[model samples]
Target: MSSPPEIGTAAAVQVQEVEHVYGTGADAVTALGPISLDVPRGSFLVIVGASGCGKSTLLRLIAGFEQPTSGAVRTAGERPLPGAGAGVVFQQPRLLPWKSVGGNVELALRYAGVPREERARRVPELLERVGLHNVAHRRIWQLSGGQQQRVAIARALAGDDPLLLLDEPFAALDALTRERLQEDLRLVSERTGRTSVFVTHSVEEAVFLGSRVVVLTKRPGRIALDLDIPLPRTGLEPDELRALPEYGALRAVLSHAVRDAAG
Candidate 1:
């Protein structure tokens, strides 16, 4: 297999004092930011906080769905644009119900400008990358919730977008499935060396998935804590890694930060 790309040269995403507001004047409410963060290349960075902390708002800003009310956001040193810079996975699968599994991924590849012949070859590869074997022909409704989310992930990975932005992608799944997908995503990130930003409200999840974790305060959402996780990224199984003392320590710290910040 080929080596993973050299992804540590510079920041993959930069948020420079960004702030987002929902409305203007009396109706205006600052939803997020006036905070800055730099996500390094090939890193899995998780942003964790309370529900109203603007985690999703920050994510939208990075994806270029919404511009910041003030400050700036960049991906690969350029202003982020829709359908450029990042591949996004939301809490919902958001797949087209009419499309087959492979069809969904093919559409993403098509939008990504992949040739028709190349898309056929690439669809299965993307599905396999997310641990989906040969469910290509199945309808979206036929798949389980977990399976649907896996398709969403495969679709996101179909493109060569440098950054992967996940907004609580596993939040709706049951515990077992969520844990399994978490492990799969971790392996995928290690293999592909893509810079990823995951947003979640779970401290344990944050520590498990992030090379670095940032905890945000409530409301306008400032950074309360920024931590580097020194745990091994590969080799050990998820359970084994989670049982380590170091993992427990980081979780405890994050748990405390979340509680305090949410108040």
Candidate 2:
């Protein structure tokens, strides 16, 4: 793979020799072993591995929802601070049942200390960005599964943070809806120039969305392969990228890595 991006430069996030373990002593389990990686500013990085491979654990560490058992995790030149430099989207929408779609997003802004008056303006704009402005006043229950996930994404972006961490956000959707959202996510990431780290078990999704794809080994996850994706980044449809010969080659390589890790 091309040299990994330099850490703490313009890169939006950094993970250096990071490890995470659960339980203690005889019962200890290392969910993720030491691994180092740097994600270039405004680039999309996808981590793909089987279940129990520490994919979600890594995202959690970067989001500061969990502290590392050892080593360091940093974003923008400092150790990650909870709710500081990152925005996270999980597999489920996680919207408050009682809140309107706009209200859900507005809540995230409020927690980020956005002025009340500004939240009124920002909420609509964010919904529009995610193609859900028409449902801005709708209750969370009114939206389809896909639409709810879009709202979740809007809420995550409401913070306008530099780093975005997504853990299988589209895994539960039907294939068609998942593909559509993947395209939307690619466009949004490109438009906003935000650095993103997405974790998923889908090789196709990883190859399609990432500037670089990092595959990890099974339990006690380790970086098994870091592969650069060479699909053209400009004026190309997501489908077109998938059709490219390079895309298929990369997919095959990642497929093998996944099998090896699982075996």
Candidate 3:
């Protein structure tokens, strides 16, 4: 796998003094920064905060879903273009009902301009990367919720974009399923060596996945805590790693930070 840029190199993403607001005049509500952050290439950066703290809002700005009301968001030092430089996955699977499992991914590959002949080899390859094997023929509704979400992930990977932005993509799953997917995601990012930014409310989730984690304060959000996680990124099972005292310490710190930020 390709390694991340050297520590002091240009960041893969740069959020410079950005702020976002909704509405106008007296009704306008500020949603995000006046906050700035840098995400280095091939590192997994996770953003965590209480609900309504602009977690999703920040992720959207990075994805170029909406331009910030102030400041700038740049991916690889260029203004992000929605659906171009990044691949995004939302909380819901949002798969097309009429499409088969493989079809959904093939459609994404098509949009990504992968040739028809190449799609045959790429579809299953992407699915297998997400741990979905041999279910390409299944209908969307036929698979369990977890399986559907896996398809969503595979489709997102089909874009083969440089950055991956996920907004609580596993937030709705059962504990077991969510944990499983988290491990899968960690492995996939390692294998692909992609730069990723994930947003979530779960402290454990943030600490588990992030190479670096940032916490946001409530309303008109700003950075409260920005910390790098020192846990081993590879080796050991997820459960084994989470049980370490160091993991518990980071989780506790973020949990408290989130509560205070919600004030």
Candidate 4:
């Protein structure tokens, strides 16, 4: 088991007065932020909004892929650095086609600086954690889309990075597969106690996955609504939690917020 993060410690991610613009002058387009947020350790934070609301752009800034036009974003009290601060999962699995399932995760472990012997030992364990057990030898093309995504998730966890950043990771899957993966991811996050930031347009997903959900306004995204979900994260099935009245209420509010923000 992984060690739990200390309670009341500094936030895992902090964004301050952040804004992002594209191009410049006549063609300049303001894409995101002038927003601020603090994500506590071990929290599952979901940012939801309409298409083009800059949800993904905000995520990129947090991941250190892009810098904000104004303001600052810090992870672990320093400016976030690409390939250093967090493990990221994108909408597509993007696994290497030539590598076997285990090879993909092994590569991540190697990049994380795990020794060769340790990487071999850790690969299977990571696959199992993402529920891809016994398929470590399968080629990427042989697996279903959902299964490939599981490998992507396993690879993300290979380093045991303290922060997990996902950008619509389940958006391309069928509804049933998406729901299943959501449940699996929630369990994984609870077990590992990693700080997570998820970006999606689905209000239901935001409420279901987040310990806290923030809705962003339309382009030049800003916080439209910020809510805390107090639903039990353990000892409850996914369907049962989704059926809760509080869950519905939160989803409804987020849905409305997203729609209004888009207009």
lDDT (Cα, tens digit) per residue for candidate 4, span 84-162: 8699999999999999999999999999999999998899999899887799899999999999999999999998899
**Model 4's lDDT to the true fold?**
0.89
For candidate 4, the per-residue lDDT at 228 reads: 94
* Candidate 4: regions farther than 4 A off: 1-9
Tens digits of per-residue lDDT for model 3, 1-263: 12222222388898877888899999999999788888999999999998899999999988888888878778987778888978899999999999899999999999999999999999999999999889999999999988898999899899889899999999999999999999999999999999999999999999999999999999989999999998975788998989999999999999998888888
Candidate 1 Cα errors over 4 Å, as ranges = 1-9
TM-score quality measure for candidate 1: 0.95
Clashes counted in candidate 3 amount to 0
Write out the backbone clash pairs for model 4: 18-34
Candidate 2's displacement at residue 16, Å, is 1.5
At residue 46, candidate 3 shows an lDDT of 95
lDDT of 1 by residue, 174-200 (tens): 999999999999999998999999999
Candidate 4: Cα lDDT at 85: 62
- Model with the higher TM-score, candidate 1 or 2: 1
Candidate 2: tens digits of C-alpha lDDT, residues 154-224: 99999899999999999999999999999989989989999999999999999999999999999999999
Candidate 3: stretches off by over 4 Å: 1-9
Taken over the whole model, the C-alpha lDDT of each candidate is 0.91, 0.89, 0.90, 0.89
Q: TM-scores of all models?
A: 0.95, 0.94, 0.95, 0.95
